[model samples]
Target: MQLPESQVAVLEAANADEATPVDALAAATDLPPETVTGAAFELEEQELVAVTERVDETISLTNEGRTYVEDGLPEVRLYEAALEASADADPAQMGQVIGTSGLEGDEVDIALSNYARKGYGSIDSGELTADPDADPAADPEATALESLVDEGTLEGSEDVLEQLERRGLAEVTESTVREVELTEQGVTELMAGVETAETVGQVTPELLTSGEWDEVEFAEYNVEADAETVEGGRVHVLREMSERVKDVLVGMGFEEMDGPHVDADFWINDCLFMPQDHPARTHWDRFALEQPTHIDDLPEDLVDAVERAHREGVGEDGEGYHSPWDEEFARALALRGHTTSLSTRYLSGEEIGEIEPPARFFSVEKAYRNDTLDATHLLEFYQIEGWVMAEDLSVRDLMGTFEEFYAQFGIEDIRFKPHYNPYTEPSFELFGTHPTTGELIEIGNSGIFREEMLEPLGVDCDVMAWGLALERLAMLTTGAEDIRDLHGTLADLEFLRNAEVTY
Candidate 1:
């Protein structure tokens, strides 16, 4: 019987008496494990070999876990220190115990959190007490870590291993281990004798030069064979979504706008008609720059115009906040809470000169806010900002624009509720039903720019604008329940890798 070189090599290495793993076969046959695996599957299909597959989990200690094995686990060390300080009978100051434990920075917190959970001790207020009966030496997680160090793997310690993994002290990976053994047919074939066939796996330069390619037999590929999955570099889901948004907005006849991430409150809020004393302008909601506290290059005329609008009002009938408006406060720099600063800059001819009437502009940019992190909120996020400077713009135009924009992403059921924004009159929040949860999520805010905002920017025409959450738009499209899952320290890599940006 004649077989491809790889198949013949695999057959010669595989044993009838014992199953040999693909790695062992690869070593014996001098072929890649994947090649051996593919050959084994082909032999199995031909009834020449039996291939058995099982998932094998590999356990290994991380750098931190190794350190714990050498210096003792943080919690264990803390307990020992507490006991030495007579904490078993009475509470000891946490700082003193931690200092004695030699734990610093994040390790101190790690020790404290796990100490209570593992029955090592109780941490009350600012004190720590060691449990006299607690045995740090017999700690399952510590024992598991030691076992991994000694034996290079673990068994019957799933719970402990999981705990260690959660603590970022250990790593566990699963791989499909395939073992091949000769079947009755394979044994018979070996007895009958098999020969290696000269089959070309790929076209070579020598073969082409010699004009022997036509005469050579090509090896048939096993397309069904399990191959290694390679997770090559890919554009992040958020970045991809941002680019897609740019494309959509560009298609909708809007030119992209660019500006500073850190800008003067003058353009960010003052130009938007937000009073200096507005709650949203406070340090609690906005990130203020410390070193270069104030912006030096604010346009003078625009600053005066905005200040007048803030203090005295925009038109004859327009009413100001009557609040104390200070140029010094307006010049204070902060990480932009929104990308409306770009709109203000552009409208006032401070950015790319004055954008004339009937012009459309948009920006997909980062905005920093000291927001309470939650399922729907993040500290910093991409805001899809846009504005239309045209004649007689209205709420209908803003609503229709949002409807068209979201519809492109397959979200047709957009609902709007009247909301308030200091910059825009008749402001409303945009909501879209989450595909997975079916709950209406606040996706964006939109309204026509109020006279107080526009007149200062030297814009005589009507303007409708919005600052949409790019992450929320992604959630609506990708069905991610938590905004953190999109991007952050707790980002779900598995979800991001598989998430498809619909539309």
Candidate 2:
């Protein structure tokens, strides 16, 4: 019997008495593992060899995991600290115990989350208690990490490994391992004497010139063989969504706006009629700057106009906040919490030198805020700010515009609820039904710009504007349950690679 060189080599290397891994066969035949695997598959097709596949997983500790193995698990350290404070007898202050534990920032949260889950103790009302019976030294996860460090791998403890991976303390990789062994036909053929035959793997110019292409035996290809996955560079879902949003707005007759991310409070909140004492303007909510605290270049005339509007009023019937308004406070610089600052700059004719009626402007920009992180909220996010200046506008116009815009992305079930904003009168919040959860989520805020907000900006016509959450829009479009899955440190790479942004 005759066979291709690669196939004969693989078949001779494979043992009939025992199954050999593809790596071992490659070593014996002095061939590449991929080539040996392909040859094995081809021989299996001819019923001369049997090929079996199994998934092999490798586990390793991440840098964080290694640190824990050396120093100690965060939860274990917290437990030891609590015990030292006599927390096992009575609940001790969480702050004191945590301070003694030497855990800071994200490590504190990690310790708290795992401490209660491992039958360690209970945390209640700013207090922590340790379970005297619990043994921190015997924690399965810590044990697994130590074993991996010493032995380079683990035999069992799948559940513990999974928890470690979830906590970002470990990594697991899986690969398909193929094993080959000779069948009855292969052994019989080997005993009958097998010979190597000339086989062509590809069509060559010489073969064609010699007129031997028709008579040459071509090697069969195994289409079902396992191959390596190669990930190529592609546009991120957030960037793709941003471009699509710009295109949609431009198509709707809106010109893009641009401005500074860190600006004076004069344009960010003062021009919007927000009170200086408003809670949202406090350091707890806004990101205040340290160096170069105040802006050096605010238009003098515009500053006077805005200050008067804040203290006195906009018109005969307009009334002010009846509070102190200071130029020094307005000059303080900070990161803009929303993109409305751009609208103020454009409306005051300071950006492009004056404006006409019936003009449309929009901006898709980043905004910073000191917010508690959650599934829907992040520290910084993209805000889609827009405004329309015309003779007359109403709530009906704003709702219709939203309906038209959302329809482009296949979202039609939009709900509106009355809300409050300092700059817009008759303000309302926009809500959309979540595609996956079947629950309503707040998507944006919109209303007609009030007289107090517009008169100071030197705009005589009515303007309707809105600040929409770009991440919420993406959630409704992509059916993502968490905003972190789209972009963040904990973002899901597999989900991003496969997530499709329709429309």
Candidate 3:
């Protein structure tokens, strides 16, 4: 390939100093580092002083190549047989979208029909094909990725994940999710920008005429089409629902409490009256962090209270689980599976001391469990945990709040099943009717705080804590069999951004 002016400059610079840095070469040449590097590479190929990052390919060509015979070669890469009677075409039918436009349409339909056999991102298309020559030593993407990395252009392990994400090619935990519910104001703006995706930026001559067309990616032009009027973007349905729940708590004059996705067993299990021996504590039932270490700074009283409850019930009966509480075990840190721990702190702390007679708190944080992943379960997920405490909170109040919160999510048919919990006196499990499945899907569990849990916190009144699975609600509302349907879609977001999902 003919070397560009930039490459010629890189050649001259490399010959001048075998000691200069890659950055210095770019800076001295007033060229971007990548361009400078590529130029330097071409110079080496043309027989200048040889240098390269690859160990096996150290130097460029030598002067001897200048005299090498130019072999006679065919100009064309390939040509079809003259008048070849149609490449896999019917003998007579030539008009109606046959071959790619027709055949591919059928293939695409089949791929979509059995989605269980494939993924939304996976399709029977040329773009989805694996690189024919993906070398262990030379993944082109990796080479670019590595070069960028070596240049300090890429930062974290997730940096590539982020880059791919920014261009709508990557997904991360913090990525903006278009929700299925939107405010009236959001819908107004969305309707305004509906055709925004269709309009492309004017292609500058510098780009189309740069002779760097080989380097330009075709995928960028393959932007998602907006010709067919469809949904736009917004937050995720789960997030939208979670926000509604948050709003409800705030409107109820309840303090919105927050906590870590990771928590201590003392807070997650013991403080909330979860028995260590309970099946939920087993690795099979819940995700236990690889290392069992406590957070650096934990409230001493919370630790002590949780410990006391574990050793002996923190109740009027003054009896614990009738077993010795393991302090070391309690101190072991864990991924927070529910938001109840947030309430544990609010109910029994000196910070709340004498500040109020009645209080309420809630959380909508991601939780982790160890169930096999399925439409019904995920190893890591989110939960809406909450609690209410007062001079006289009763079962009636519990049922009232349950009905109200579910109703907020457009769920009305709910059944309460008698249940048991280490931390509460009268425990219950809440099951909501699945909209599409018509199955009684358990959404959450709740109960009044048991003495072992509250007595240690020094709380004088009974408290109840409950949590709902946000994904379950999403599945019910969207009629999606897979939890992933709630994610990775502009439609999902548009639906949420325009959805009116509240009382």
Candidate 4:
């Protein structure tokens, strides 16, 4: 092959310096190392240079790489070995490396392998590892602790702790008993409110077309008339849903249940009858929090029943979950993606345990996912969750409550199709007709809690659970085509402000 100008330059440079490493070549040439390495590689491939070797058949060439010698066109050397050794490098790095390794011929490739191993780390299929021969390190528990501290989720740092002791949000921590507090700045931030004002003089007509106002601070320059702007003055839509869901429960004479969103994997998954080895427990499926609260006090009776269920399917010990359900794995912490968090929440209330005939509870909050953001998917979105606990609660009871509930929204023709949710037996995936679109939309899922799920919550009765995407509901009601259209707007917020909040 006829050598290109860049190629000839690299071949000449290679002969000038014989033993220098690729890294040094990158600097010496004043070029990105990848460029030099690249051209040099081309020269070697054409029988110009020779290469040498390492542990595996990794080697360099033997002759002057792409030799431009005594004759006009020169005796070109195509050193296959040298080119092969540096094959993984970017074109620029290859050119520089070949130039620096001043080997007279193709032997430069041997030097390139040495270049990568030392400066670039271990080469695996041409990729670099920080420390190749060693196993990658898993995150240390302390790293998670540090993250929680950074996020202001955890308390303790002796100096900070001591200062917090005396002050509240700004408390001076002198003792171990630091009050959990938020600063006035933090309070304003957490309560979600902010105010700003701006007034800017219009630029002269000449300035307008020239972008003269680009860097202007309109807020600081306002004249006589005062104007103000305020934002974040409301609870999140998800939070609003939670309140509405709670109202639905309270109106039915049910009290709220409280549980931390930071509970361990055991309560979130295992206690709820999820198998430890199930795919949902994997990192891809759920958002595992750095510092999670572990539910240590598993009600013994429920624990035994679940253990039996797992050891044997629904009934017999035969064909049941075989492996030992790991207790440690169960205690892992993660964000509560489902309002089923309400399950443990209700269990914590004595009234739930003492309730006579009928009891209902609900929760609404954001569920997370790894889905890509699009018209129909989001990493986070709102879920409206509700459930009722009672004896012999027929599927009819379940349909009746839904009747009253969906009626409030003016939606009709509610129907359920058989579905399987891991925690619910006789489950349902709800479908509703889009009032305007006339298209059938599957909105949510519901089912009476399976024996496996209820056993963990200490509930012996049939507990029915149902959930739907609040965002989807909003999208339908607001005539939105995209999922993102649902919120963070003045109109949407105003709608919530004015919407009927029926009990």
- Give lDDT per model, in order: 0.87, 0.90, 0.55, 0.51
Residue-by-residue lDDT tens digits, candidate 3, 114-166? 22222212223212221222232332223333434246333335544432332
Sequence-dependent TM-score of model 4: 0.48
| Candidate 1 structure, TM-score to reference | 0.72
- Per-residue accuracy of model 4 over 35-135 as CA lDDT, tens digit each: 54554454345545432212322111112211211110110111122233453343233443334334533233333333332333333432322222321
Ranking according to TM-score, highest score first: 2, 1, 3, 4
Name the weakest run of 10 consecutive residues (lDDT summed) in model 3. Answer: 72-81
Say which prediction, candidate 1 or candidate 4, comes out ahead on TM-score: 1
- Candidate 1: which stretches are off by over 4 Å? 1-9, 12-20, 27-31, 52-174, 193-226, 317-319
Q: After superposition, how far is residue 347 of candidate 3 from its true place, in Å?
A: 1.7
TM per candidate comes to: 0.72, 0.80, 0.51, 0.48
Candidate 4 deviant stretches above 4 angstroms: 1-249, 292-304, 314-319, 348-357, 488-503
The deviation in Å at residue 255 for candidate 1 is 2.6
Q: Estimate candidate 1's alpha-carbon lDDT, on a 0 to 1 scale.
A: 0.87
Q: Model 3: C-alpha RMSD to truth? A: 23.4
Tens digit of lDDT per residue, candidate 1, span 351-411?
8886778899999999998864557878799999999988988788888888888878888
lDDT of 2 by residue, 1-503 (tens): 99999999999999999999999998999998888989999999889999999999888888999999998998899999999999999999999999999998867766886788798899887799999999987898888888898999863577787667766678988888899999999999999999999999999999999999999899888888666679987899888888889999999999999999999999899999998999899998999889889999999999999888888888898789999898999999999999999999999999998999999999999999987565678889999999999987999999999999999999999999999999999899999999988989999999999999898889999999999999999999988877877888767677689887776
Which segments of model 3 are wrong by more than 4 Å?
1-232, 290-292, 296-302, 314-316, 350-355, 488-503
